[model samples]
Target chain A: MTMPSTPRPGGRSARIQAAVHQAVRELQKEQERAELTVPAIANRADVTPSTIYRRWGDLAQLLADVAIEQLQPDQPPADTGSLQGDLRAWLIEYFEEMSSAPGRAMLRDVLGTPGHANAGKCDGFLRQQIEAINERALARQEVPIDPEKVIQIVVAPLLYRILFANDTPTTQAVEALFERLTMPTKT
Target chain B: MTMPSTPRPGGRSARIQAAVHQAVRELQKEQERAELTVPAIANRADVTPSTIYRRWGDLAQLLADVAIEQLQPDQPPADTGSLQGDLRAWLIEYFEEMSSAPGRAMLRDVLGTPGHANAGKCDGFLRQQIEAINERALARQEVPIDPEKVIQIVVAPLLYRILFANDTPTTQAVEALFERLTMPTKT
Candidate 1:
């Protein structure tokens, strides 16, 4: 959640981080997880084995880090003036990204890490984005929906379908839920 | 979903199946997945390695089978007369079972197996139980909710929390969903 030991914006550190992550992205395209070892990744990234070991611990951790990097939001949620507009745009984009093949693979990679620390981090990232949307709604003098409800009502089913790698809902389906959430109800 | 190669009824085949399944369960409790090889399992089950090799092909398939065996429903869904009664009873039991540590481990085991065929099987098992509940409602002349709706409203959130391996909801939260699903609505 707190960046998971990622190096901050800099010269050499940033360059190496990008190189190593890019190396993983390419190697994973050809090799299975078991075959993608530290030395191999180090060689591909043009770094020594000890550098990877000191930074990421093992392939499992590195894969988790790379997947997390792919999933992180590079910008804040778009402000659409109304909660309905804001949530619909945000969630539809999410549905598109996460329902894609690479997104699904990254999700599995994050979840497959030992102790599920990456899963927690992924969850944190989602929750933070939802919180931002809710804050915007509150500032706009509109009632904000509960972030927990968003997790249950929207994120849950969306992710369930993604994880199953089939039976994913149409964008319109998630849009309907977004409409339902922003509607005035007896909550 | 369709038993996936499980031997049916009583016979030597069933005996062998039970012995192997039990051996896998016992070994899994003590050892990590990487260490539970075919020879080790055969030795523990008092069977031949060739027997396991011929039957299950490899450790991944065997582990999937054992997890499936452990997850299969041994009985039909309970008929509580009303949809509310039936769904609440079923969902609460599922929430309890899947929230436990061993249950979570078993879920990860099934999902971890390559290809995610076992995930589909697990989904089918759950859907069957829900279908049974819905059929009972129809027979009783009560309105039945859609099974897909049940997947979205209940199973999705339930499995999402279970998969994350932490922050599972309280039993009351799931019971409340069961209540909501059975409530009269303008669907």
Candidate 2:
């Protein structure tokens, strides 16, 4: 079967994106069972090893792209009119997604690659995602700070607990998080 | 050279732990340059491939074991009574350790392995580190809740931000984390 565009100029970006996503899905599946290689992914995506390499930096980068794409929730959590509701929904869903095999693999790949540690890129991307949720919280007048930082503070612990502490965010823990972030300061 | 070990019947556990840590350090160095192998690690640690595999479960497991060992930090931050001082010290030191190459590698290994999703292990390990500081805070009557829970909530974001968001905990951000967590509740 003809795969999508390769990572080149012209019509290649879309095709390349599709091919890369497919390759990532395949690699993620393999990662669940065992380690994956560039050749194996190339074969599955029906692309050449050189083509895959040329497009992405390496297997890690390719995997990273796929992981990021997939790691993002399909859409931000719906605005529930309250900051607590919105954050709860967002965090619980986000945590559940990260706990998935693909989600976990993507997290591992991102964490694995050293060059991926560009804070500006990571912050901008995170701020963007949090902004979407933040805007909703703002519209509802539920959030107290810039929605972006609020989101980071609210949801960050979920990802952290999962990745570092290895603890899933229990309902109690999520509520605790909500209470901690959204509470008005006692002056 | 012989390393320290616990006196126990299953000398295997301590031996294996040392081997795994050594292997992880070597592999991570190689991974930085994009070339790592079970054999290379085996050679560096002077252990047979069979021994490495037998002890750690697989290459990923061996990699994970080494990385996992680093997750447990040495001690908690000094509690100087003020939340800001305690948190800033805690976060900066913690992030500095985890944000470094070795810390990043350990985070990656934890994410790489599927079986490590158990956060209970992480919580227990971190509580010990956090308690060292939390205890100091408690002695000074600095915190409101259980020191363990406070530690978890306070430090969770730092670890989370680093591994998943690929961001470091800035001094300002650390302050924000403390401010939010330390805010008095409706209770």
Candidate 3:
């Protein structure tokens, strides 16, 4: 558990990792989470269970490694006319995706991973998305708000509700957060 | 994982559950998390491994049940007169406790549990703590903010930091959040 999860692999390692990851993704689509043990994944991946244990430390770490990769945005955040528009659009998408059944499972994998490295890597995706939007805002001559503040104001609450609260978070809640963040402060 | 975790029990069930839970708590102290197999726990509890699996489904559910119970405050949140004072003191202490190593593991257990029932139960504790503080505020004739909003503003951020962020949250950060929450609104 103290060992670092190889979330990102390279060169020769990528081949084995990809096979194992693909096995995980397909199995996740096909069966129950309780059935997703290390031996099952290793068998499907054509590798020994010892390989999984040696590389990922355990099943949770392996799932986390796969989840962190999948959760990454395939492309950068789309540009909108205004920073407000861009941020709102991005957050709405983020919230909806994370609230979906499959998305929640991915979230559980990353957060449940005992080593925080995978979680930290996932955090980077949010910052990157925000930065992309902020860069566009700066280009448009609008003052860019800090990414950390956006994370605190929006992402935290959405995730908290998604994982812990019995009720699902509504898209309107994300909108409300965006409005609250963008509205001019009274002096 | 699909079955409900026996987070609380009544009558005769309590005796066996207590034995199992106490064994888990003690074993957690003595061994690595990876070494805590159902057989080991059952052996310590003086029950068969089948008993552990039959009752709890898996180690995650059993661990989650224990975690949610330990998270419950032994006493109610202390009254510090005003809602602001009470909330600030309460959140600061909460932030510290939850950020501790053992606290993070407990949080992981609750969040990682597949059923989500345990996680929801843990959420109730936060809401209950807030209600206690707000009741005191009402007695003093001071307006009490929504408990949900307090959770949204403070608890969400603190937990996001504790569970996901690479760095730990600071007491000063809690104070800053409290100030923002209590600050006068500009029209």
Candidate 4:
């Protein structure tokens, strides 16, 4: 799942990319992804349709790009001097964001879009985030566990509730999940 | 979440119900749930649409009934005389079934149907199965753990892979998940 590179910072081309991404997110909030069109997005962003075509190739590519951008953390959660604290903070923030209206709409678009295999892209982003946190822990001389194990223990259940069960995870559920994951192992 | 009662055994009505259920499953394999209709099901089952309506109330109700029926084990996985063995066996079977074509179709219908709210029904069935296993473990004098905890460790990851990531959990992944869950916790 190779994601599209983020546009280079500070230029006319970068500005257009930003505007287009914002338009895509705003449109997702207003309607399902099935209803979005390149022309409509061009109109929303005040860019020409040919410009979007030249840049994005098609509607699916454009939507995929937007989905990936929304998933990237504004800034990765700050380190809290312990792996457990970092994980808890990161996940709590993630859960809260995912439960917000805009977040839910973004998720629906990513997951429910026809013929767009965005799950792998999302999964890759999750793996990268967990790996980054584990790297921080390793630097602090804390033992690093498999990021996959962390995902199974922490991220999977919260997502299961959100997508399949249509339930927002409670703070207590988050805490319980973290506790179970970080509990001392028996010899 | 009140699942329809399974019909009693050995009668003409039971026979019709069985035919209808079989028809539903076969049709699910053949087409998406959105394409299913009472008349179509009746034609496949060689029964009257009136019979389907009289018995199941609506297409959504009929579909839900079929889903629950398929999900219910002929007999829940046998106790392997240890909690770990029992859990591993149950989950491996569950993982295989859910990744099967029929199972995936049923899951999609249960999750994707508008106004169908089948999550509670599915959740209830899972909790019931877990409790039954726990009771058997307690009879053997094994310590009981929170069923919700077990769900988080075992079921959630497998499901997340299937529905969100589009990955059928590898055997290695399943084993790792179980090992993590069963690792002894410090007091």
TM-score of chain B of each: 0.83, 0.74, 0.90, 0.80
Ranking by DockQ: 3, 1, 2, 4
Sort all candidates by TM-score, best to worst: 3, 1, 2, 4
Model 1 lDDT, full chain set: 0.76
Model 3 stretches with alpha carbons more than 4 Å out: A1-11, A183-187, B1-12, B183-187
Off by over 4 Å in 2: A1-17, A23-32, A73-89, A117-126, A133-145, A170-176, A179-187, B1-20, B23-33, B73-92, B117-122, B133-145, B170-176, B179-187
Question: In model 4, where do residues sit more than 4 Å from their true spots?
Answer: A1-69, A72-75, A78-85, A101-116, A134-145, A163-167, A180-187, B1-24, B31-69, B79-85, B113-116, B138-145, B170-173, B180-187
CA-RMSD of model 2: 6.0
State each candidate's chain A TM-score. Answer: 0.82, 0.75, 0.90, 0.78
* Superposed Cα deviation of residue B74, candidate 1 (Å): 1.6
Worst 10 residues of 2 chain B by lDDT: B1-10
Clashing pairs in 3: none
Residue-wise lDDT of candidate 2 within A1-187, one digit each (tens)?
Answer: 1123234545656765676578767566556445577788777777788887777767666666666665544666677776566666776666676666556655766665555542224445556666676677667655444554454556666666666565666777767766756443323
- Give a tens-digit lDDT track for model 3, residues A11-104: 5567788899999999999999998889999999999999889888889888888898898888877787888888888898888898888888
Candidate 3 chain B: worst 10 consecutive residues by lDDT?
B1-10
Could you give the DockQ of candidate 2?
A: 0.35
Chain A TM-score, cand. 4: 0.78
**Model 4 DockQ class:** acceptable
Docking class of 2: acceptable
Better of 1 and 4 by DockQ: 1
Prediction 1: B-chain TM-score: 0.83
Lowest summed lDDT window (length 10), candidate 1 chain A: A178-187
Go through the candidates in order and give each one's C-alpha lDDT: 0.76, 0.61, 0.83, 0.73
lDDT of 4 by residue, A1-187 (tens): 2334755688788899999999987887788544688998999999999999888766656766786677866666679987777888888888988877656655654653333266567787777777778788878777766777778878888877776567788888888888768532222
